[model samples]
Target chain A: MSEERKPGEPANEISRRAFLAALTTSAVTATAAALSPLKDVVDLPTLEEFLRLHYKELTPEDKKAILERIAAQVEKDYGVRPNVTDPPPIPGVEFGYALNIGRCIGCRKCVYACAKENNQSRNPQIQYIRVLQMRKGSIDVESAKTDYEGEVPKDGFYYMPVQCHQCRKAPCVKACPVQATWQEPDGIVVIDYNWCIGCRYCMAACPYGARRFNFEKPEIPKDELNPEMGYLSNRPRPKGVVEKCHFCLHRTRKGKYPACVEVCPTGSRKFGNLLDPDSEIANIIKTKRVYVLKEEVGTLPRFYYYFNL
Target chain B: MTLDRDEGSKRIPLAAAGAAVACLLALAVVFTKDLIGKGPGRDDIPKLSPEYADPSTVRKVRTEMTFDGAPCQACHEGAEPLQGNPHEKGIFHEHIELKHGRNQHCFNCHHRMQPADFSNFDGSPIKLDNIQLLCAKCHGTIYRDWGLGIHGRRSGFWDTAKGPLKTQVCIACHNPHWPIFKPLKAAPPPHINPRTRAKGGKTAGAENHGGLD
Candidate 1:
């Protein structure tokens, strides 16, 4: 027994010594490599080049620099410098949408606001919202759906507001190959328009059919433009990318309501914290029978609906 | 049996347990209150479909307040669009009076007629389903543009490349009667109740949201 225990001692000591020696050198080398400053890579050629960098790869300073440059360029383009993306102290803002079916007049104002908010061009072609006029009790999405005519809503029909539902459990996020779109902790799903290559994968993934593709470059008159824009929500999206409603993250992050919700003349839209047990929306949902558009699909859409008695 | 029986007799049983419980009862200091009964499901949202007042979500009512020439339904010419070929004839070069001209707004065409539609100059009643025929009377260029899927919406089952339009009807996106157009996908926010929610205010020209006069 003594021989068995003592005979391997030298071999064990030798291997342990070798392992420690190798570990020490690698540790020292790795520390040195990581601590080395990357000074030369900071100074890039141009703002357009800076804009081309992926959002995640940007450092705090780099992000700030990029935002400032973009804001300045926007001032030059539209003459009205709107506030660009400012990092919010509160994280996990998931945007939610709710529409009052009773109050919708089908005037197409929300669509126009989306265009202005997102800096969509004036081609008069992009449709961000689809307000359908339907005869009562019609559940068929196609048959009940009617477009805007000069006469607007006719008698014996209720207006059903339709748009990107901003689902809590969005399938579009899973379908993206490049992670171009993601659901924010606060509950809104957004696309990294720059990162998107116009694959149209998201369009197929969406059950509500909320995403829109720019068939052509947007054509807004030079003077008629919204300058201050959202980074992911409303910045002038390039052609061949998918876009959807974001609950106006640029406005909502600052505790301001979205332009669409604010522009609605009727109190048809309700926005509040789902986590808060005391908010008006929560109370309304608690006291009344609240329902989502398609609860069956398990999208967990933040948009809720309850009719007024 | 004698030794086991003696140990069993010495063992503590319910008597000791009762004594321990009695001692702990002084510390328990229990209180009593009425139990609240619970029911199924929550009621938080203000109302539901059957209860909601606005019938727009259920049945649509045409707005009366409108811009000029707001009765495109009065111009439905009563012919299915060029059956099967997806193309139609143009009329703009043939008649100046039939042209969309300058009066082109939703009110000029696409206007919802209440209880009745208007008569054309020939004293013929306008049709609602064939508003495109009225536009073909003047806007033949636009008509061809629509037919080739260039001027208007190019939408349908297989071909989604050129037009966003799925419909061949001129007033499908445009106001066929007077002709100023709003994008069909643009949804105007509703006039919401201030006591509950707040949607946006007036969009587009001349907020004509009344019954057709």
Candidate 2:
């Protein structure tokens, strides 16, 4: 084949080898140039994070190490040492929330309180609760307004504040491609932020429109950072993850009312263990004209909306 | 050619029908003027009374008066205790606006003789500590709800086994004189993102959106 080359053509063996070498050099250089932007990425996962196992698969020792790493990262990022813990769900306790639609004044106190407690982004705000001001005669949420100004409990209109229903049949959990989110034994739906791939599949799956995607790095002020953080609940979430109301699991798991419940001036918000027969939530469910948001969809939400009258 | 002419002629009746329907709708709207936008107006809705017997203010006054060891008796010891309506202008306690519906008599709630303690239905002295009993006289359902941790604010813990739960007294949230809760200035609305502006310049998911985005 080399001897049969045209008069102007080089020897076949030598020319072919040189051409192959030139192609590889160009390919390597192009690849290096394309990856050059990666150098500016300050939050690239460390080796431990890259090799981390799934939340369920992590051993006790692995969890401890990971928690410590998270604490350190939070400290470095926000200049505050967060007390992060992964509290297991209390046995025989299925958490439930009850809101009195009759009494809710649409003050949005709960909305702000939740944001403060959860360390949600301030600039591009990410509040979990949306208080819809609806006309009194109708239950049509589609025509309700959220951005009403001035003093609330507007005449001829009632406020219906909606948050994560923490559905027993959570569509978000089922839609998560990586199983990063799931319902806890206590019936609170939680997310493993570290494991989330930010595909936003869960956001699309949620019927309540409860899921919020972090389009930019969450801008929580250092002073406003909730130091009492839960590993699976309100720990500072990284950019490109989906978050929703975790029922303030950090506080709720430890037997405290969620921040929203605590701040409600009208005493419209009620929360307690549904399993306990004498609990306030149980009483509200048994006595009041109880209803849930979007009941037709069959989410079986633990959150109950009720009328006192 | 005949079919084309027939199709063209059919369009005129359809246009007339459309015009007739539009005229009917316009007339219907004119006739239904009162029905449209007939919701409760600002004037029709009862204004929240400005007189609020703020629990803190009441506490402050009680403490200041009792600081000298004798409360109302300090002043009333020598002088004759004036009777009749306590809310009348120029009366000693005229500033206390009795806005609580229908329970007008001052001695109905307050002890006429002692003036320091609350009065039960039979005019017996009820201690200040048992304020729920006083409010429970009229608001029995609220009293029941408060006991079950449904009506009023609860703090500290939801699980009694794990921690202590503290339920606020009725007086802590509502004033005894006014009784009704004062209207609160609502917190600022959620920040609207510029990118998600839907039609009418409202946030895309402003209603029932649960602050997604």
Error of 1 at A148 (Å): 2.9
Give the per-residue lDDT digits (tens) of candidate 2, residues A73-166. 9999989988988888988999999999998988887887788888887755687888888899879887777778787777899999988999
**Which candidate has the highest TM-score of all?**
2
Error of 1 at A280 (Å): 2.4
Residue range with the least summed lDDT across 10 consecutive positions in model 1 chain B = B204-213
Off by over 4 Å in 2: A1-38, B1-70, B77-90, B194-213
Candidate 2: residue B184 lDDT (0-100): 71
Model 2 per-residue lDDT tens digits across residues B81-195:
4565544634466567888999887777867666666788887777777878988998999899889888988777898778998777877677778877776777766655524
Candidate 1 regions with alpha-carbon error over 4 angstroms: A1-53, A79-82, A89-94, B1-213
In terms of docking quality, model 2 is incorrect
CA lDDT, every prediction? 0.53, 0.76
Clashes of each: 92, 0
Candidate with top DockQ is 2
Chain A TM-score values, per prediction: 0.77, 0.88
